[model samples]
Target: MSEDEHETEDLQVEVAGLLLDHVHAPLLEDQHVRGVLPAPSEAPAVRVALGDRGECAPSRLTAYEIPLGAGEELRTSHDVVALLRAVHTGTHIYLSSRVTSVMGMDLYLVDPAHVKEAPFTTDDWASTLLRCLAHPSEERPGARLRGFLFREGGLLRLYMDSDEVPGVIAADVRPGGALTALLAALPSLLGEEWRTSDAVDDPHCRSLVDLTDW
Candidate 1:
């Protein structure tokens, strides 16, 4: 899809909100959408506060500035994965405009990468589970997926049992692919760098990982 087509303001706000709720960090006094950007400039964005994660450093805090918008900003699962992969203490992203729409929810959500997987959103983890459990047949009905979603520490995680698989499957919210595994891999991915560096390690850096529900 073109950049213009990918801008989903509601989804962006929802994603930012997920990060705020689940990312393990100390929220600064100014971490809200309005708080992050004072009056006049106030726009839609997720201001995240994160704990430092260097294995050998003293305690410190970090905040991530993630901007939500359309085509001009982080537009793909790959972009998000790379952003998470590269952040140090935290990262900054800015969507050029604000979300002013007040539209109702859509009947279907299609992931750019996986048409078979339909992801839904709610205010938080508890509600997400309530949705999955509310129906024995799953909200999707005959769809082939029985997945429950939740957000925790920068990750939107999905724990599911599929009719096609004998064991449980743990997934992050994403288009189906290897990118889904990046969150759990952050520790080791950072570790490889830690092992070779002489600088005092930041534990936060070593442990930071985000998620999504499939």
Candidate 2:
């Protein structure tokens, strides 16, 4: 279907999964809602954290420190994925195919290009994303996707950043269509110019990707 429809579907799945996890593990009932993802449980009993006050604010732009259970504290975006793998051990976090439109980062869910069995080009990727973000909705005329980076594999990364040169930029570690397309476009996407190591080492980029059943 359309990108917005795909995003909505992905969001529904993510929320359902989160709710299911909570049902299985009461300790993780404290759900923090951030970015394009919808607000977590609103019941008074649930400890929910809404990252922004506005409707379409940037998704967790600056990193915040949060506990990863078991006394392990890590930054939200940077260390989350690695830490999640470490703590949860075997949980899987799926990613979408279109690198330009990663679920939860650019949009709230996995949105593949509308074309079937098609290898989406760069232009296709960018335009599809634009349409998805600007899709007309009942609440708002269109979406203005505010965030610049995505939270996948527990690390926050620039939305358009592509890894071409080794060690110059971090590659997409999350398994999804976006990673596949991004890796394919690495040669043209990444730059020859280099920056200091500190520029890429974002602390909030480190978040745990998976949550264990408590």
Candidate 3:
């Protein structure tokens, strides 16, 4: 082949590889979204602080912390997995987002036993969450697990709608918290970076899932 043709072919291959990498990158590896992951055994206990409210731009937000025992830290991904396992043992787990419209929000529900059966890894849990967040109608009924994860100002928010006592529980991502660990582990979990944007017109925002559901 001609030198110029060979060079063109090489360029095409390089471009293809780059595209593949981008397509496979994790959805939450962005520095702004990344969270810390701590060792589960040494992690601090996280208490569920109720009635904690804050403001994020145009709306007032309320956070309902999830209670944790010693060596149970929401700041670590491992603890998060444990929490999910514990909660799912006998009840339904629903993930939901903040109500942005008068029509209300859709709740994503997942099978607890299915999640529990997954390998005890951060990536496994993250994958479970991503699967839950996928387009509900497009997904099977068993995958319609409900929950919400999004960014509000400087805080990363997670909301759980379950059949438990708290009913609707919320967790704000702290430094090195489970939220961060989940986001950090997402890329590895999905084999690609998942991209999201704050712009309302963005595809993520306009679609069934958006930055609000991150």
Candidate 4:
């Protein structure tokens, strides 16, 4: 693995540790988790909660720098925690590495999430994550979902695909209510080319691609 990959794994490990440390344990389970999930409906309107405490810990800097050990970079626990929280929440993506390396990592993570039973591969990851990020916001719910990107040679890849999935089946919200609004918004976000030719099957359900950039 490259130095960057090593750092990302370190970040994930660190974040997993935090989930074990900070976030209330009860919340991890589906029961007390409340409606972190979406409601059930055909189509419903939703708005991006700008005021939501959208944050990235170690926000100022992702990876640490060392010099001679002087200008080198190091990863921190806070960075990992932030990424884990975002992923667990179904937020889009997050990172724990320096900005320069993030784009590449994103590409690496996408395949594992989208390819399903198919084996994850570098090319699969590249296409999935790149398409997701390259796609526009209307195609997705609040673009506020965030994550880190890592560099792979010259390309930017998504390292993590967070919980951007709308809680369509959870509670209160109908299945596709919020997702429909987002889908409606996609044509503009990704330009007319992204307009889905097929009719929405369930106005309430948010397709995996609908929530993320892909």
Candidate 5:
């Protein structure tokens, strides 16, 4: 193949991986992501008094360099699909790089109290968590939710002390929401039990890739 063609291929591969991360970050961190599953039109949202906002609203959400070590860098669109499927299969995908950013999001903990309350299953609680983050606000446009880190065996605990609960979720509040298009493609990934160590078989995550648009 010609050098220019190869370079373009490399670029596409890198961009594809970025696309995956863009979507993966929010799903990992955002609370009650509403659409990961099919929601009914009349469903009651898992409502809680919005946390004491502002004082806790943070400037940056950082991920430990640890969990990131497990993410895989995908090269093809199919790889992206494989990862997305994991969300529905009781599996998860974590941000694979050291590039966690400052963004506004909604994140809540596994409120054990809410666990037994009827009609809504754990799925409803998780969906509510996502909706709170994705809900519209004035700080940004298009409700650009971004960089969500959970507490207790959460996605970004490497940077947090062992005592923090209900980690922060933030909005892109930045330029393009960077992964706006990508995040739109997946569903909420919030129902997993926290405070426990579990292993996931995620093919969509990797440390690096041989760039080829193949």
Candidate 6:
């Protein structure tokens, strides 16, 4: 084997590992419960809302799709500057999306009043989400657990908390109205009794690949 050929093979291995860690692992876990799923052919739309007191009423922002593929650098594509400008200090931001067959929801504990704010650019949702997911600073809180819910066969499966220590729950429910109603009622239902119930599983400590680069 030539030196150049060996280098190329090494690069291929690295890329494969990157895909397994960032893209394939999370979806593969869902597929274990849901069977085969379709690739994300189109970018998902983001829904944003302000968490007022304890009640959260979200509205649809502009529908912007950020590209995600191999050999592509992740950057912000949406007008995040305008959105951040409008957001007040100490406001809790809720971002949710239903992309293809996956429903993902997240919470950002925004503290814009602090000396250092969450690092994000005015470009795309991918960069924003990546920053929130891989945030380094401990002073400012980043993404919190709203969980990712997948539509599997005839059931809806939800995985909450960090990917490493996920709390999973499933139900024989479809998306749209039923799912929306369930999410709306989740706050009341996600108490100690709910966690201890037979429907919810004990935290499965599965370690996901650490996301280092975009």
**lDDT value, residue 69 of candidate 3:** 30
78-180, model 2: which lDDT tens digit per residue? Answer: 1222232232223324354422222233332211121122232333333333333334233442112223344443333332222333332332223323533
lDDT of 1 at 12: 51
In model 3, how large is the Cα lDDT of residue 139?
29
Q: Tell me the tens digit of each residue's lDDT in model 6 across 30-113.
A: 221111111133222122322222232222111112112113322222222223323423443434432221233232322223
RMSD of each: 17.0, 21.4, 23.5, 19.6, 24.0, 20.0
- The positional error of residue 90 in candidate 4, measured at the CA in angstroms, is 27
> At residue 57, what lDDT does model 5 achieve?
46
Give all TM-scores, in the order shown: 0.29, 0.18, 0.19, 0.19, 0.16, 0.21
Task: Determine which window of 10 residues in candidate 1 has minimal summed lDDT.
Answer: 101-110
Please give, for residues 4-111, the per-residue lDDT of candidate 3 as tens digits. Answer: 444434433332332222223432232111111221343222211111122122122111222223232112334433443343345444556521221121212233
In model 2, where do residues sit more than 4 Å from their true spots? 1-11, 18-163, 167-194, 198-214
Better of 1 and 4 by TM-score: 1
Residue by residue across 1-214, what tens digits does model 1's lDDT show?
5443334444454455434433343222222211121112344333333343322111233333333443455444223322332342133233334212112211111122321212222333333333333343434432122344444554444444434333333433432344324423422333232223321333222122123332
Candidate 3 weakest lDDT stretch, 10 residues: 30-39
Write down the lDDT that model 4 would get.
0.29
Query: Candidate 5 — what's its lDDT?
Result: 0.27
lDDT of 4 by residue, 1-214 (tens): 5775555455444334333322232322231211121111311110011111222332221221111111255434333222223333443342433123331221112212222122223433333333444454444434322333334343332222223432321111112213435434433343222432222443442322322332
Best by lDDT: 1
* lDDT, each prediction: 0.33, 0.30, 0.31, 0.29, 0.27, 0.29
Better candidate number, 3 or 6, judged by lDDT? 3
Model 6 clashing residue pairs (backbone): 76-123, 76-124, 77-123, 77-124, 78-123
